[model samples]
Every structure is written in C-alpha cells, then in structure tokens.
Target: MSEDVLVVHGGTPLRGEIQVRGAKNLVSKAMVAAVLGETASTLYDVPAIRDVEIVTGLLEAHGVKVSTGPEGELVMDPANVTRAAVDEINVHAGSSRIPILFCGPLLHRLGHAFIPDLGGCKIGDRPIDFHIQALREFGAVVDKRPDGLHLSAPNGLRGIKYELEYPSVGSTEQVLLTAVLADGVTELRNAAVEPEIVDLICVLQKMGAIIKVHTDRVIEIQGVAKLSGYSHRPIPDRIEAASWGAAALATHGEIFVRGAKQADMMTFLNVYRSVGGAFSVDDSPIGGGIRFWHPGGELQPVALETDVHPGLMTDWQQPLVVALTQARGLSIVHETVYERRFGYTTELRQMGANIQLYSECLGGTPCRWGRRNFLHSAVIAGPSKLHAADLQIPDLRAGFSHLIAALAAEGTSRVYGVDRYISRGYEDFDGKLAALGARTERP
Candidate 1:
C-alpha cells in the first residue's frame, strides 16, 4: 500500500550498480515444483517480490511449509501436502496466474485441486486452453463452476504426446509439471525453450524427473512414480537485467547490473549494441555482471520483432521501446508474441513520445497477428524530447518502462498504481532507484 503512488522529478541520468536475484519467471515455478517433491526442497536467490509472497501463501494454503533457510534461500517442505480449502486457495491466488500451474503438482499429490479464478498482467489473450487440454489429455476431469475451476484425476494421470499450437511459456510449464509425475512417457513438441523453462526442467531433473531436450523444439519427459526434494539456484532475472540496461540507455547513464548473465541474453545484447548502447560483460567469479551505458552519441534505431526463444523476447520489448524513443531515426517494433502488448504505448505517447501503432506486421517477417487486425506493430520516430505527464502503471513490465520514461522526460511525473501492478514482479524498485540516484518520493 505504501507503493501506491510515486512522484518522480525527471530529466536526470541514472547511474550506479544494482543486483538482480533469481528470475521472476523461474523462481515461482521452482517453488511450485517443490510441491511435486516428497521431501523438502531448497531454492537459493529467491527474489523478495510480491509474486514469491503469493506463491508462498498459496503453498501454505495447500499445507506446504515454506520458510527461509539462509540468506536469499526459500525452503519448501511438501511433507504434508494436502487439498486446501476453496476460500483459502482463492485468498492466496486471487490475483495471480500461478494457481493454474498448481494443477499438475496438486493432481499428483492429492487426487484433486480447486483453482480460483486467476488474474495476472492484462497483456493480451493469455489463454489457458492449452493448459486445460493438456490436463484433460493427462486424464484430469475439469469442471468449470461459478466459484472457480475444479479438477480431479479419477483414473490417475497418464502421459500423452502433446504438441503446442504455440510455444507458450505457461502452457509448457503446465505440461512439464504434469507429465513429470504421470504414469508413462510424455513427448511435448514445440515447447518453449526459454532460459526460465530450461531452469525449471533442471529443477525437476534434480528431483528425479527424467527430461530430455532436443535441438529442435521438442522435450521428452519420462514420468516417474515418485520424486524427492531438490536444491537449486535459479537463473538470474534476465528480464530485470534487460530492463536496467534499457533504463541506462534511455537516461543516458551507465549501470552495472550484478548477476546478469550474457549467455541468457545474447539476442537482447545484440539488439542493445545495435541501438548504440555500449556494454561490457564481466564473467569474473568475484565481480561478475554486465555493465550497460549510453556511450555519448545519438541512439541508433533498428527494426525488431518479438518471437519465441532465441528471438527478441516480448517482455524485453516495452523497456527497450522507451530507449528507442531517443533513437536518431525511425525504430520499427513488431510485437508478435502478444496481441495487446503495445497497450502501454498510449501512455508513452502521452509523455511526448512519437510512437504510432499499426495493425500490419511492419518487421521483416509476417506473424500471426499480421492479419488479425491487432495493433501489434509500432513505429517510433525519435530524438523526440520527452516531457513528463501523469501516467498510470498498466502492467508489470510497462510499469517499469513508464518509470524509465519518467526519468528521461523533462518535467515531473506522477506514476500511480505502483503498489498494485509493478510490485508483482520488481523487487524493491524504489530502493534500487534511490541507489541509482533518481529522485522519487511517495505521494
């Protein structure tokens, strides 16, 4: 509640070092993976974010005892996993999409699961059809009630060869979690091979799940009868790292992001360099991180499209767009991952950005959204001197981008709903901003 509003005095460069812990994308799923284990599991570098708190509460609702082990450690003991009361489940999971992931692990431990209506960032049509269909294929009976979704595995779970229509991260995680404990072998094609997903697979493997990854988009999992605990240190938050990188570029400052991995961010790094942002990768064991800065020149503009793994991630698009606003020429951005991801551009435009959205695919490749009449492509003509305006935080990533835009703008900006939206992913962002010398205060 204290983070509900922030008043940011703009037109200042952000300079300093910030550390990003475990990824927001992987940490929650790793905690949920603990539910599939019989004994206790330990996850290191768990971020102090709202999403982790939500998952901790949800796990507690289902009787998984969650506690801190050491510094930055989350210990989850599923020794007493059981079915939680409906109200209890709803209370912990009402505002998160994490509950949908609880389905697979819950069905394996208990016979059933009661999932409350899920909510997350309203980025686009994030459908659960792939999840539901995968569950049904694995022998779970799904009942859609007015209260929420009720799922039961009457015949027990059995593996199936499933192919994803699209390589969705959530859907792939759902399948992996379910298939790990099913009766037989499960082959998933066109799976999302994001670093977070791979890290999740590593967690499951440590817990005795047999998983094989192919060069192509195929993942084969051999379901086991039982699984024990695991100890894992999740991958660094690449999304958060890229965000800070964009922040540095947009504000014409330098930032050293500790724990940012270069291998995980090769695509983003290439694009960052293309935008005329300078970076140095330091992989030394003691002082390892990527240093990002605007190397005292006009920011370059280039065409970019968001795609699956090994492509420009959709999550990386928003913050980078803020940096693109200062580019010397036209920057074309085609968002193919989510149809409604450009929703935040309207807010950016209000802050004096010259961004225009189009329905056609403006990049090199034509995407699914090309003919769907979705305003998924953007043309930003920059070197546009930005001036601040009152803005509302739209979603998790967009909220951070809004802050970046505010820092780059001329006047003061009143960014509202930070507590409600931004805190869901970012951990102690105000503290990080203060460390970087950006002037902000709660209003």
Candidate 2:
C-alpha cells in the first residue's frame, strides 16, 4: 500500500467532534517570527501539520533552537540565528511558500539571506513582485539568482511608506516581519487585515513591537531597535473549522468543531446560514465549539464570492462548493481572490456535479481576473447526484475539497496524493476522519 493514495468509502456522514488548534496559516508564520526575536519565543496550541514541520526544519537550519512542550507548545530561540547554510539549497525542496517571508527578518539580523524558489498550493498565479518591491522600499538589495533569490541589507533596512495593488496577505506579512525591526516608522496602506494576519501582528507586538491598526485597512508599525521573544496562543484554525462546517453540510451530518470561534467566523457563519446549514456557537473559554449540521433539509444555494478578508475566504470556497453541489437551485461563485480556483470544479463535474466555468465575472464586482481569459467563476446547478470515481488531489484547499466530495459521494473513491497535499495543512486528518466515522484507508 502506498501512502500517497487513499481509499474513501463514501456515503458516510462525518459525525462526532474534532478539535482544531492554532491556525495552520498563523502557526507557520509565527514560527518564522521567532527568528526575528532576540530571545526565545513560546507558542501554544500549535497543530502537528507538515507545514509546521517544514518551518521547524527551516528554523533549525538557521540555528534556532526549537523545543516542544507537553502538548503543541513550541519554544524557539533565535540567539544563534545564522545566515542560511547554503546559498543554493532549497528548504524542503520548495514545498513551502514561507521561505520567501524569511527574506526580511534574515536580512535584518544577518545582513543577508539566500532563499530558494518557493512552492505552495497551485491555486493561482501568486507572484512575489509586491513582496520584492516592498523589500526594496526598505532599502534591501535583491539579486535574482538561478537557484533562488539573494537578499542583502547593505545600507540596513529602514521604514518606508508602501501600498499594495491588492491586499495580499503574504506581502503584508513580509512587511510586518521586516518593518518591526527597521529604523523609523512604516505605514502600509491597502493591507490585508485577515484574522491570521492580525494574529501575526499580535505575536510581533508581544515580542515588543509597536503596531497600530487604523481605519481603511491601514497598518502602521513603529520600528524598534531590539525585540525579545513572546509567549502567545494563536487564534484557532478558522479555515479548518469552516471546512468541517462545509463537510457536515455536504454529507448531511453533524460535527462539533471544538475551538471554533464565533467572532472570527462571522462571514462564514452568515454564508452557512444562507446555504441553509445550521450552526450554533458555544463561546466557552474551555471546550468551546461550533456545532454544524445539515438539519434534515435540502441545502439551499446562493451566490458567493471570495475576497481577501472580512469576506468569504478563498480557502473556504472549495469545500463549501462541494456542499453547494447538493443544494437546491444554482450557486454562482465569483473567485475574486484566485484566478484559477475553479480548477477543482472539473473534478466535481466528473463526480456528476452540474458545474459550468465562466471567464466573465459572475457578479457585480469585477475582479482582477476578469477579462484575463481565465475561467475564474463558476455556476453550479444542483442538487446533482454525485458518485465516486478515481480522483487525484491537486493542491491543499482543492485536495481537501476533493476529499470532501469523495466523502459525500455514493460508493467509494480512490484519492491519490493525499499524504503530500492534505497533511501539509490539516493535522491528523485521517485520524480525525476515522473519529468522525469515515471509512478512509491508505491503499
């Protein structure tokens, strides 16, 4: 049996309760932030995902002593943070996009950094132009190399005013990690205020950085001469939480997601309600969770769009789209965030989903992808009866969506490359599926 493949006996509703810890999006970046600190930093409730492992390995490569606590607690010491060992080595052979984020902090501390080509989920064209420009604005010298990117702060990093064409979360993170220790103040406009980004800012603040979030998506960071480590518990995984919520809907099951927060999931909650999926929030300090269920009725479809933050998140779009296949009427999804997000819809169509992709923007909001000749929008006509088939997992979000489709479809589905993609984000996913009574096995 190969670990890359999975056998999913579909028609099993994912029931029972599963707990999510700190967000995958946050925990990995927070680990990178520890390299920016002078002393050791402690983070609690970290998930055991492959991304975290990659980040831990990258940190160790830079001489950061990372240790674990009883649970998912990690303590990182950057006292011996070193210049990257090899100028040409690609960390994790480029399995992560996070390596690009290290350019800022590494330049600030070691005066230079060598980042190999970065790799992440192939959802769309996520370029690093804004990130490079922002770094250049901070007075860092960048040289493009065959192996990867080489960055050096010959004149040292300084604060600068920068604006993004889009509210890109990665660029915002690059700026935050660099600006916090630069000279003078940094004002960023049209920034990404995603909950994960805000939480990352808080982590930096705990490490003795001063940051202010003002009106109109503006974030100001006052550069400090020095910063110590921080002790923090990151926000729970909202993306994963929403995935389960959508899973419950797709399979007509009920699932209680522990550590799911209400405040962070307002937009998703509203959409869940709009789709006729029922959810109740329990905001207890301990053992709190969101109970999501099908509520024994036909799932309603609605027009949906993906945006940066405070909008329907792009990550949640795929899984929920699976649920929408079972909904009454048609569902319009305008993917404003990623130009090629509808790629997974093809697999869904193969599973008997009545979906059509469009190059035109399906909604009133014309996104950057419109008129770019990309089929970024989708119209799903349902409730379509889905049957299992041989499937291949593409990227992370789409992989999870494929898994959800397989779980919700009739008969069984053979899904390949689950170990590579799904484990990168979802921790203990197979175990969790088993606990949820899903018959998933490695074949």
Candidate 3:
C-alpha cells in the first residue's frame, strides 16, 4: 500500500474496536499551553496526528524541548523557550492555524512574537481579527505586514474586561492563554464553554493559575506572576468516536469505540438515537467505551442544528450526513457554525446521494447565516443508492465523511488526499479501518 490514495471496496460494514486518544482540538492547545509553564509539562493520551507534529515543530523552533515518553505521552520543556525567526516559524507552520495561538505565550515569555501567514481548513472565513483584537485589549501591540503580523507587549500584558461578538473557541483560548499570566484580572463575556475549554482550564489550574467559570458563559481569570508545569490526561476525541459511530450506522455495522466517554457525547448520542441508532455504554473494569450499531430497520430522518457546545456539533454533522443518506425520509441539517461546510455534500451527491444545498435556514432556527446567502443548510432525501467514484478530500472532517460514504457505497472507490487532510486529526486511520474489517488499500 502506498501513502497517498486509498482504494476502498465498499458494501462492507466496519465491525471491530478502535482506540481513540486525546482530542486533536485539546491536544494541540495543551501543547501550546505548555509554553506558558516555567518548567516541563507532561501530557498523556496524546494522539499521533499532523497537528501535534506541527505544534511540536513550532514549539521546538522556539527552543522548547519536546520528547516522547511512554506510548501516547508527550513531555514538553519550556524552560529554554525563546523567540523564533518569522521565516523559521513559517516554514514549520505549513497549512496550520496553530501559529496564531502562539502569540500570547510568546509575548509573555519574550515580550515579542511574530506570526506567519495562517492557513487551515477551507470551511469558512476564519479570520485572525478576533485574535488580534483580543491581544490588543490585553495591551499588546500588533503590527500587520505582508510577511506576517508582529506582536509585542511594550508595557507588559494587562488584563481587561472583554466580550466577544460570538462565542468563538479560538478567541476564547487566546484570552485564556494571555490572561493567565497578565497583570490584573480578566473577565470574558459570552465565552465558549466547550468541554475542551474546561479541560484547558483544568490544565491551567494545575499550573497554579486561578480561573473561574460562571453561569451564562462567563469566565474570569486572575493574573498570576509565575506558573509551574502540569501533568494531565487530556479528554478523548469525541468527534472521532462519533464519526466512527456514524460510519457503523451508515454501513449497517457495529463498532466498539474504546475510551469514548458517554458524558462528553450526550448531544451526539441523543441525535444518534433519534436517527434510529442504538448505543450501549460500558463502565466495567475491563474496558470503558460506547458500542454503536444500526438496528436493521429503516433509519429515521432527523432535524439537526449545529451550534456551540451542548448543541449539535458542526464536525459531527458531516459523518452523520452519510448515515442520513441511508435513512428512509428527508433529513434536514442546518449548519449554523460554518457557512461553507456544505460544499462537501456536492461530492456525496456525485456518489448518488440526494442532497440539496440551500442559502436559507431550513431547520427553523434563526441562525447568523440565515440571510447571508451562503449554502449553510442542507435537505437530504435519503435511501439514495450510493455508488463508488473517484473522491477528492476537501478538509479534515469532510474527508472523513467522504471515506464513510465510500465504505458504504456499492463498488470500489478511489479516495485521494487522505494523507494530506485526514491525517491532521485522525491517527492511524487506514490501520484502524483495516482492523475494523474494511477492505481498503493504497493505490
């Protein structure tokens, strides 16, 4: 098997157990958080994903000592942390948005930081304006140039009260990373309260940082003078677990996702059950995970709206849409999070799925993209016969969705660009697929 393209033989249900490690979202951020520590920090359950490799390169460029310990463990030493050149940083940050997150930690450690051109998934207009604005609020000077953005704390960072127009997770993380070592108190209004955010707070607290989470999406951080290292086990990737579960449902198979936590998947579980998927949780001493399966009946259609935490996740919507294609009736998916996420559905349609994109909101929710004329909503007419095709992966989550469609299709499928995008999040994807009885090989 080569490393670029996956030739998947379809019409087989994926049945087996696959282990999931730390979340791609939290693990990268945690690695970044290690920069704020004065000593060394050890993170357990780290996944071997592209994002982690990118962050490790960026951190090492800044003189942080990153080494591997036991399996699924990363030890990061930031005691020798120093500023890295813009070109040096840019070369290592290829197609990753993680460089934008290094701003606050760099400013605190070296009083200045330079961010190269940021790149990430082409799912939406993910601007750095929010990050820059928050940095300015914390008294950091930002100079925009053609090369990149230069930031410096001329008078040192000072905490200030700030509120976001929307509860953006990246912006909120920027605030936390900066405010933890600021001069005074920082209060954030309309903050993102995702479980990953909470886990970050836990990591910060372990490093002697004081933070408070209040009701109604409020977070207060009291600035501290110094911080130690942290030893933490990050939360598992719920998105990957749910994606595998959706794959099982789409192909009419059963899968046991070890290390999947039930508490973190409540919203997805509810939606999965509503779509006629059955899941059982195991809390025994032997192993703990969720078992998901299709119950050999007509899958029900569901009306789903993607929102922030405690709501339907935008990441989960893509893989679930593949399962929705096998349902009996029409399924409505309102993607309120990212406007351009529906672009991947076009590829699914090529595989014989009946999906229609709409500019108007269709799930009866008043969303921010309602009148924006973006294809933010989709109506999927299900039970469409899916067939094999040469598929191109667009982004990470969408790439996984395409893989699910390929596995559930009728013939052989040639899926390209899996290594480029899907490896950014999913670890050992082809190996895991092969373990789950998938007939796939690299072409």
For model 3, the superposed segments whose C-alpha errors exceed 4 Å read none
Which lDDT tens digits does candidate 2 get at residues 336-418? 99888888888899999999999999988998998999999999989999999988887999998999999999999999888
The C-alpha local distance difference test score for the whole of candidate 2 amounts to 0.91
lDDT of 1 by residue, 1-443 (tens): 44598999998899999999999999999999999999999999888899999999999999999999666899999999988999898796548999999999999999898878788988898988889999999999999999889999999999999999999999999999999999999999999999999999999999999999987899999999999999999999999999999999999999999999999999999999999999999998766999999999799999999999989999999999999999999999999999999999998999889999999999889998888899999999998888989998889999999999999999999999888888888888899999999999996
On a 0 to 100 scale, what is the lDDT of residue 74 in model 1?
90
Q: Give TM-scores for every candidate, taking all chains together and pairing residue i with residue i.
A: 0.99, 0.98, 0.99
Error of 2 at 24 (Å): 0.7
**Residues 231-299, model 3: lDDT tens digits:** 999998999999999999999999999999999999999999999999999976447899999989899
